[model samples]
Target chain A: MAKQFKSLHPTKFYRDYLNHDIRPDGRLISKFRPVIINIGSIATADGSALVRIGKTTVICGIKAELCPPKSERPNEGFLICNVDLPPLCSSKFRPGPPSDLAQITTRFLADLILNSACIDLKDLCIVKEKLVWCLYADIICLDHDGCIIDACLLVLLTALKTVRLPGVEYDAAIDKKTINEDEQKSLSIYNTPVSTTYAMFEDKVITDPTAEEEEISSGLLTIVVKNKELCSIHKPGGSPLSEEKLYDCISETINHADLLITLINTAVAEQND
Target chain B: MEGKQRSNVKFVFLKCGVVSQAKGSAYFEVDNTKLIVSVYDPREIPKKTDYSSKGELFCIFKYAPFSCPNRRAHQPDADEKQHSAIVKRALESAVCRHEFPNFQVDVYILVLENDGSALSGAITAAGIALAQAGIPMYDTITAATLAIQGTTKLLDPTLEEETLCTVATHKSDTEIDYDSHGIIVLAMLSTHEQISEFYQLGNLDLETLNESVNILMNAAKDIVPLVEKCLVDYVTKTLKSNAES
Candidate 1:
């Protein structure tokens, strides 16, 4: 591991900033950076979206393939989400195997997708037990400035909205194969889930924490919510927080979700138009 | 490429190439692993202290964080540097470096997703990039790695399979079968049917090494034509546009 220099002491500075009701970036604690969402950037994938939250940038590509469903859930389709943090994004990431942080983030995003009630798995099933459409949602962090979770979620949701699955064709003669590009159908989703991450330092909650801020923070909280319901809450931190504070973080995330979803919808609407 | 599992792993080239900025670019996917490569010409070399008669080629290989099941670190590491050197060597062998004296061409490869065989993917990408940049090359180079697990030889093993095989082979006290021992990565120039570079990890015997070379040469033979076709198509398109202009 490379030696790293500590930035400002977030625990002490955050407390001062909170007392003054000012964040390090000169915004209120509840504020977020200016976000821009673009859909259908990758023409090769079934659906794709590019999102930029402040300086953090992410690209999400969703590809749907046919595969055998798991034995327990033979009637439903499968959703797999993977996040890639290339070295170009940051100097800290190595090129080969994934580190612990990458694994945790991938799992967290997968949980968010699974719990969101967004895509109807039954519709993805080609046959009862034999074949199902497996949607692979691959998220690439092109540039990591901060607020990765929120930017990643925005990309995933926008990509999902723009995705159109090729129609599935079934042939009785052969053991069952989903039709090729010419014969496929798009998937219908119920709700879109947006995620917001907050870093709490020195009794102050900072929204869209930057890379430097994340390094010095006491604890980090990621909240994934859909339609006012909490889908996933991932808190990987050393410092403990009071239940009341956690509740405040969740509420703040929910409020952020409302704006994120609107932004996603508008981006999709513009793409369609 | 030389081993029992060589046949199981296959490389396929898809035509009607994508990626517009590259002078010559092609998309090749080895089974589940996919990569796109674009080559830029020998532009004016960066003004620096040293200017060798042999031209320089700048290479950059990137794996999208989600390329593997686990998220990739947000930075480059030693492995990337090592692979970059390997790619440079593989291309240097086939390219006529003296032709572009005082000039440098750049090869940029991006791995969209990686199931296995990322190094080989980069080698193939660099070859395409070189051709795209209109640099004269004797032939295209194709590279592949072969790993042995016990009596079973695995071609292009995934990260999981690689770990399992490495542990299983190194732990046992049984007689070391050089044929099924260690990992061998080979790069071959298809037209000449010659080995450009060979790297081995762990212990291996001469016979196994020979067999591995043969296997990789065969794989290179299969890949060369596809790359040629892509290059021809690209050149034809460029000539047509030039005539029209």
Candidate 2:
């Protein structure tokens, strides 16, 4: 019925549907779409993965390089994340540089990953106060059907899980020049944090909105969960959301996070085999 | 005194902030062939032309001094300009220009390494840079250079192959011997199976030309899907990370 009325405003229709505890996509107020994940697809990258949430798609690749540890955190390695949304993904994106939106999203994702302590920085240290592995996680958006933040996090987690460092070889014959690939090890991960996004339109909250739904929504909230613990909360646009609604969203995110973790673990396990 | 010569060439893509001023920048290396491509964005149009129906895209291809084996001149040379024109045409056909009406997308490519098919490398670099910049297009364009030697066609021909192909074809002066006259480089659009751009430096017979196109097109078709998958995978990760954050 909603698809038939192309000209009708989604916000208005969503509001009407919310009164009856339903969504236009035939899901309940808290329901999410099906998700699919694949890992270790890019052989060139140290670690990589591809994830899909309904029609939305994302890919994340991690490259590890040896570098000097930070002066402040000499015993630990560093992690940096970048997000690229090329014009080919959508008509709204233009060719040029990263837009303001992309910058914000990149920073936010980086903060979440760092704060969540998903990776153990100490294990990345090759030499105390000297050398460490600087892991660069580059995430790219190929399609923007909707629910971008959730899709991005899924790919990142899947990539990290599937990645294995090449063996590092210390060549005694060559003045201790180490061959990084010969002595490789897996990254030490403490916990996996999965993310979920919700769009609030006219007091009704929708889970994993599509691009069309996102465009019409007034505000969005992204919740990250690690092992049943809420690790991060991002509510861009500063729209007022009640504590009750926030808790509800978190509960729903935690539930979906379990499903996502299962999907990611299964994909990684398949790759290992 | 006949020894086989083999070239050891490797290419890697690095996310370097060389073009800090630009929105998205990437450094590409194919053995000694190094280049940096930067994407700007849908910025205000500088020209006073009323082509405001959609966004405008501008491409600038330059070769840095000392890029080649020879000591290059200080100013932009004629060959550089010609290469830039070819690259611009190839990109223009691949990108959807009508997406941005009043704004312009600027792609600046600086070649730091000059091996054979620098233009083709620059085109590929530009495509990646554009994707990094987050501009919306229908698909990513992947390009490869071909050298036809009699019945054999080589992909990503090295500098030695470049010279050999030139000599093998150019030395033949007669019109009937034109098929052996030189090599052809084609820039193809992989998705639609269309030839977005083509460049042939040497003379070739019509039959040879048709055969070369077919060979190159088939090779390009094989490569297009790989590039598309790469782009798709990249974007999917970015979105997932965003959601997680």
Candidate 3:
């Protein structure tokens, strides 16, 4: 009943807006909602950032802990990204193991951050095969307004930038690692990757689609770009796009990536100040 | 210990209807501790039962992975379950369960940051959210936590203050014996002037316990006005929008 009602009213309403080259929220076909970010708000975590894309709010907190590196990749550290869409964020979610959307977003984000090589895991190693930093990036969505992937990616990367690890002194004799809080160093950022999500309904496209827009759109395109390089493109296969249209999406991502990078830099600078 | 008066500090910054999707929602902050609660619409109970007259109140209390000093697991742990049970108990009686028999009103709370008194904060936020959701309630419920240290009681204690309560184990150690510490969390229906639920941790004598309860009740009362204002603001906004529409 709810699905039928959604399709009947909101879907048609969205298509009507797209017919005129505008979105339901009154944005241009390639326009995005304002992005706001606050870094280092979570004091308990080593690094943290809270980001909002339109009404979607996500808080990403990174905790750095020392552990033994994997035997095969003894020199590399570990990075894990978990996206939590708790019931508090929306009525659709429940209290239990993560839903499919949560898991998929988590995996997609983990893959994006890793494949993009935003942070070199090798730099996190303290002692070869002995001690390394395990960075856990947990992103919790407070509101599920729409375009969660973009919000999650933005917050996670911003949180990563704010991460600082204290100096660790390894005692081989006892094999005990002593952390020096006075000496701290920020993680080396290899690349800054920003993602943009577009919702295509029939032949028209809406940028940074809101929750309502996403539900009715026939296809979804999420593109991750880093330093003018295409890092990743994810589509779950709803509606097929022509090669030219796909290129248009990629170019749109490139355009938005520059703005996102500047937004992140401003947020980080404001945090340091 | 820091020469700060308990009553001087205005704790528990609160705002209601923060989550747009939830039927009703609230966000609360006290010091670094922050909690967000959303009350979803009543839905049919998934499990079949043999003729139940009253509806159910489902509560889930989650601590975000980075909410505390330690990294919490992705899944809800034993402590979270315990808090959920307490919250469910505190709210079940206050809600008019007969309104929606065979259904459940889901209250989900997430602690974004935890410095201390998270359970009490959750209870308070959940109550306000439920009220804003238009659920029928006997009265608005509010909760307050007090950490008893010796003869002094600290209201709205932080995580450190909550643990400052060290129980005296030996009688011969008079200094430590006098230092008997514990925590009392009370959820009350201020209009009815009755406590819906109470949770105590550690040990306390009857006299000290009574004194602590009084302090907690007063603290809970102080938060009532703030909750009322939030609800009033929500009602006014909703009424104006309804009128315009």
Candidate 4:
């Protein structure tokens, strides 16, 4: 049933459904597909989270290592986020360097997580300038259905929150840092940022567009909200949104942001228990 | 390491079609080492190519950063690149390349954990994945690793055992022994009883190397039943679904 509809002139089929305020998947315009989260599945990583938003699946693994602090930010730790879109995820991507879409998503995530100060870098500092923890977060897309950025942000936040850095024994004079594998401390998470993306087809707006819908939509808007405050708004190279449409999208984002935060917290709590 | 009571081989668990997105995939787990291999259907080679009758195989081997004791890089390191090439070579002989000329089959292997004998596991997993994808092959390929320490040879060595076997020994003026210690990895096509690829990491005498190959061939043969069962189960499931439809 689903396959047959997908092959039928997808754009026109989607537009026809939008005319009646219905999605091909039968979800209301404001409703999102069901989400399932699996946390701490990868025992090798310090922190890991695998999330499936509808059919789009993402896995995030966080590794912590000791590194010399940067000259400019001697007292703070480092955070690096990389997004990999390999051919295994979808046929559309090839096996090589990060594609343009992957690069954009990586930078956007860096902006959302680092610039927004979701985690305090100073908290990651082991010993002032002598030694610091460098957290590398690698987000991989296993299956590409749609709304990859939204799934990636969710998994990254969840993975970062779950990170537990092992204690360390250091001698400054000898410049030796010994990691204590037994005792561990969790990273200090300042806030949780949730992103909601929408696709605009003509004047109609759809939330959490699938791969098919995204291809037909004319404009795209992503809103990031943390603790009831706006963090960032991304709308690059699509149809310009009028003031009213933009306001509506922002309000809709706010409504869904709260839902997403609760969903994430519940998932994290379940994993901890 | 002489009096150690470690088993030559550990129990392995194999399953096929684990990765839902890939055309064909398999997950192989032996002790602490775990690998997931995915195979994509044949597709046209992107760049213009000269006339060639045989199809191409593209293989990528990667280790997740957390898979090893030390964090690995996102990009494939030199060792990983070499392993990728080795895997491609191991499987190329088994696959019937003339079936899909001017096309390439992609095989991607991701090592989720590394205990020891990862290459053998990857080679074995790739073969099963290709078969699960319905790719015609002359025979199934299986691989095994052997670590030699002096006169003692260990089969399916663990990371620790492998390290012990590869350590540099002190040389004495009175007596010197060359090609006595090293690790050997051999891939074999079981039905044909042919050696597809062999990799050695250290020195080994000709006699000892022959003995190790014999041991590795037996171990590789032992794994054939497990792969056969997995592929048979996959085919049964597919046929059952087709019948119902």
TM-score of each: 0.56, 0.63, 0.94, 0.88
Cα RMSD for candidates in order:
14.1, 11.1, 2.5, 3.2
Better of 2 and 4 by TM-score: 4
Q: Tell how far residue B212 is off in model 4, in angstroms.
A: 2.7
Chain B TM, cand. 2: 0.80
lDDT of 2 by residue, B1-245 (tens): 02332222234444433343456666666655666677776778875667667676677666543345343443557887787788778877777778777887877676644666667777767776777677776656666676666655566676666777776443346554444445566777766767778888766767878877776666656555545555666678779989996
Runs of candidate 2 exceeding 4 Å displacement? A1-10, A16-20, A169-176, A180-183, B1-48, B51-88, B91-144, B147-152, B156-184, B187-196, B200-245
- What lDDT tens digits, residue by residue, belong to model 2 across residues A84-192? 6655455576655777767888888888887888888787877677567787777766566777878887888778777687655333345353665566577766788
Compose the digit string of candidate 3's lDDT tens values, residues B1-245.
63443743255688998888889999999889988999999998887767789989999999889988889998778999999999999998789999988889999998888999899999999999999999999999999888776666778888888767645444455544544467888999999899999999877889988877887888889899999998998899989999996
Candidates in order have lDDT scores of: 0.72, 0.70, 0.87, 0.86
Top-down TM-score ranking:
3, 4, 2, 1
Ranking by DockQ: 3, 4, 2, 1
Q: Model 1 over residues B219-243: C-alpha lDDT tens digits?
A: 6567667767877887799799899
Native-referenced DockQ of model 4 = 0.42
Instruction: Using DockQ as the measure, name the better of candidate 1 and candidate 4.
Output: 4
lDDT of 4 by residue, B1-245 (tens): 75443324568889998766688888899988877888999998888559789999999998877777688877779989999999999999999999999899999988877888999999999999999988889999999998887777888887788888897564455666553788889999998899999999988878988888888888999999988998999999989999997
TM-score of chain B taken alone, candidate 4: 0.94
- Residue-level lDDT of model 1, residues A180-232, one tens digit each, is 66754666779988877788776667777878678777888887888898888
Error of model 4, residue B119, in angstroms: 1.5
lDDT of 4 at A235: 88
True contacts kept of each: 0.04, 0.00, 0.91, 0.36
